[model samples]
Target: MSDSKHSGKHDREMLLEMMHSTTKTSAEDLLISYKGILYPSVLCCLETFQALETFEAREDDILVVTYPKSGTNWLVQILYEMVSIVHNKEPLLDTTMIEFGSPEILARFKDRPSPRIISTHLQFKNIPKSMFEKKVKILLVLRNPKDTAISFYNFHNSLPPLPSYNSWNLFFKDFISGKVCYGPYFEFVAAWDNHFNDKTMMAITFEEMKVDFPTALKKISEFCQLPLNEEQIDLVARCTSFNSMKEQSENTHGKLGDSFFRKGEIGDWKNCFTEDQSKVVDEMFEKYLAGTKLGKMLNYAKYCKW
Candidate 1:
C-alpha cells in the first residue's frame, strides 16, 4: 500500500483497539477514544466521526458549541425562540445534536431550511473544517469547571446510556484526568481561547446568563442578527426559564426527561466537590486557563473561586 493508505489503516487499527479496551472496565466503557478525544460511545459511532470530516456548513448556519453540560440545551432553546419570533411561527425544535448521531442521521439535516441552528459537544479541533471556511456564526457557552464537573456527574448517572459512578469521588478522578467524554475541561476552555477574538464568534458564560437572562438574550439576538424587539425578547425569556423548560422537559428531551433541566444553578458544585477536589480543579485552571482571554471572560475569580 502507499504511505497515506498505510497510515489510514494504522489509525483504524488504533481506534478498534481503544474500543475493545473499553469492554474491560466500567469507566472505560462509558466513552470511546477517537483521535485522542473521548466521546460517548452510546451516541457516537465510527460513521459519525468520518462524516464530520466532510460535513458541509452553510454561511447562515448558527453553530452552538459547548463542552458537555455547559448549558447547550438552554442556549439552543433561546436560539429557537429567537428564530420563532423572526419567522412568526414556532417551528418544532431540532434537538438532534450534530456529533451525537450517525452519518445517515446527520444527512437528514441537509434538507432543513437555512438559518439552521446546530448544536454540538465536540471540542474545537473536532469541529468540521468547513465551518471555519464558511465563516458560520458560532456562539460558545462556557461554565465554571467546578459546576460543570458536578453537572456532568449527575447527567451521567441520570442518563441510561451514560456510565453511572458509584460515587462522585470515582467520577471526579476520571473527570480531572480528562478521561471523560470530550476530554479535559481545562483544555477544552483553552482550545477555544484561540478564537475569542474572531469576528464570527461570541463567547458567553452560563453564569452570565443566569445572572441576567434578558441581557444575555439581547446579546444572542444581536450576535445572531435575528434582531428581536424588546417585547419579543421578554416573551422568549419567560418561556425558556428554567422552570418552564423543566415542566416541558418530557416533550423537549423525550426519554432524557428533566435531567437536562436539573438545578441550572451556578454553584451547585460546592455541595459535591471536596476541598481537595476543589484545589485540584483550581490548580488545573491556573495551569491552563488563568491568563487566557477566555478565562477572563469566564470571570474565574468571581464564579469559579470557592
Candidate 2:
C-alpha cells in the first residue's frame, strides 16, 4: 500500500482504540489526531481537513462556520433560502453538513455547480487556504460558552463514540477545563476573533438572532449581498423559527433517533449549572478571555447568575 493509505489505516486503528477505552479523563484522549487538531472521529474531520487542503474555492462560495451545537444548521438553512431568492430558483442545494467526510458528499460538492455553500466547524487555522486566497464570504455564529457547553453535553450523551457523562457536574468540570471535544471554547472563539476585522467574514451572535430575527436576517443578507427586503427577511425568520425547525428536523432525521433541538433558549445553563459550577466556569472564562471581544460580549460575570 502507498504511504498515505497506510497512514490512513493506522489512523483508523488508533481511533477505534480510543473509542473502545472508557476510562479516559480528557475528551481529546477519545479523539484521533491529524495536523495537530483533535476530532471526535477520524472518518470525518481528520480526512475532510486533509482532502479540503486542495479543494478549490470560488469567489462567490459561501461558508458557514461555527462551533458545534452553536446554531450551525439554523444559519445554513437561512443562507440557502437567501441564495434561492437571489437566483430566483427553488432551493435545491442540500444542507447536509460535509464535515462528516463522506466521499459521496465530497464528490457531489466537487461536481455541484458554482456559488456552492458549504459548512464546517473547523478552526480558522485549519480551513482551506484557498478560501482565504479566493476571499469567500464566511458567516460565523457565536453563542455563550455556558449554554454551548450545556447543549453539547446533552448532545454528546446521545452519541455512542463520544464519552458519556452521567452527571452535568462531571461534564462541566471537563468542559470548563477545555477537556471536551472541540473545546477550549475560549481558545476556539479567540482564534476566530483574529478574522473579525476581515471583510470576508461576518460574525453574528445566536442571542442576537433570537431576540431580533428580522434585523439579524437583514444584516446577514447585507453581508452576503443577497439583497432581501423587509418582508422577505420576516418570512425567513418565521420559517426558521425554533419551533418550525424542530418539527422539520424531526420529520427529516427521525430515523437517527437523536434529539437535534432541545430547549433552544438562552440562559439555559442556569437550569443545569450549580452555583459552584457556574462560578468555576466564570473564573475560567475570565482567565482565558479577560480582554477579548468574545469575553466582553459573553459577559459571563453579569449573566451567569451565580
Candidate 3:
C-alpha cells in the first residue's frame, strides 16, 4: 500500500481509539436542569437520526414530532385518526414503540406505503440538513417543561420489570442529569426552534392541545394541507381521545402498554414535588437559561401550579 494510504488509515484508527477511551456520558448520568431547562453533556450519536424527507415523504406526507411524554402518543393517534377518516384507510395500527417516531422514515419502515405519516424526537443537529431544507410538513409539539417532568416521572416510575425508582429525590436527580429520553429537553426544543424556520414548522404546546382540542386539530389539519368538515373533525377527536390512547397504548405504540397513558392530566407535578424540590428546579433553571429566549419563555412571571 502507498505510504499516504497507510498514514490515513492510522489517523482514522487513532480517532476511533480516542473516542473509545473518552469517558462518554451514559443515558443515566446527564443532569440538565434550570429554568425548566436541561443541558447535560451529550454524545453525537444523535447525529445519525436523519433520513431523507422527500425520500421518505411523498408530496402528500406529514409528520408529528415531540419530546417523549410530551403528548407524542396523543398526536400520533390524532393524525392516524385524521388520515383514516380522510382516506378510509385501516387505522395505521402497529403495536410497537419503534414506530412512534421518525424510525418510520428509515429502513425499519421500508414497508410503509406512500403518503406516509411519520414521527420523530430528533433535534435538527441530529438529522440531515437535506430533510429540513426540503421544507416538509412538520408538526412540532412543545409542553410546559414543568408538566413534562411530572409526566415523565409518572411514566418511568410506573414501568413494569424495570428498576423501580422508589423516591422522588432520586428521579429528580436523574432528570437533572439528563438520564431520560429527550434529555436536556430545553436544549432540544431551543435547537429545533432556532435552527428551523417557522414556515415548515408549526410548533404547538401541550397546554393548547389540552385546552382547545378542536382548535389544535384544525391547526394541524391546515398545516398538513388537509381540511376536514365538522363531522370528520369529530371522528378524529374520538380516535385521539385520552381514553382511546390509554386503551391501545401498548397496542399502537412500541411496547409498555397502558403504562403509556398514566394520568394525561396536567399540573400533576403537585402530586409529588415539595417546596424544596421546586427550589432545586429553580436553581438549575437560573444557571442554564438565565438570559436567553428559553429564560424568557420560562417567564418567571408565568406561574407553575407546582
Clash counts for all predictions: 0, 0, 16
Error of 1 at 146 (Å): 0.3
Q: What lDDT does candidate 2 reach at residue 175?
A: 78
Each model's RMSD to truth, in Å?
Answer: 7.4, 5.8, 10.2
lDDT of 3 by residue, 75-125 (tens): 877877777777778765442222222233144454666556666665555
TM-score of model 1 relative to the true fold? 0.90
**Candidates ranked by TM-score:** 1, 2, 3
Per residue, candidate 2 scores C-alpha lDDT tens digits across 231-295 of 88877888788888787764444422244677788898888888888777677777776787766
Which lDDT values do the candidates have, in the order given? 0.82, 0.72, 0.59
User: Model 1 over residues 138-240: C-alpha lDDT tens digits?
Assistant: 9999999989999999988876556888999999999999888889988888998976656999999999999999999999999999998889999999999
The collision pairs in model 2 are none
Name model 3 segments beyond 4 Å from true.
Answer: 1-59, 95-105, 160-163, 250-255, 283-306
Could you tell me every candidate's TM-score relative to the true structure? 0.90, 0.84, 0.72
Model 3 scores a TM of 0.72
Residue pair clashes in candidate 1: none
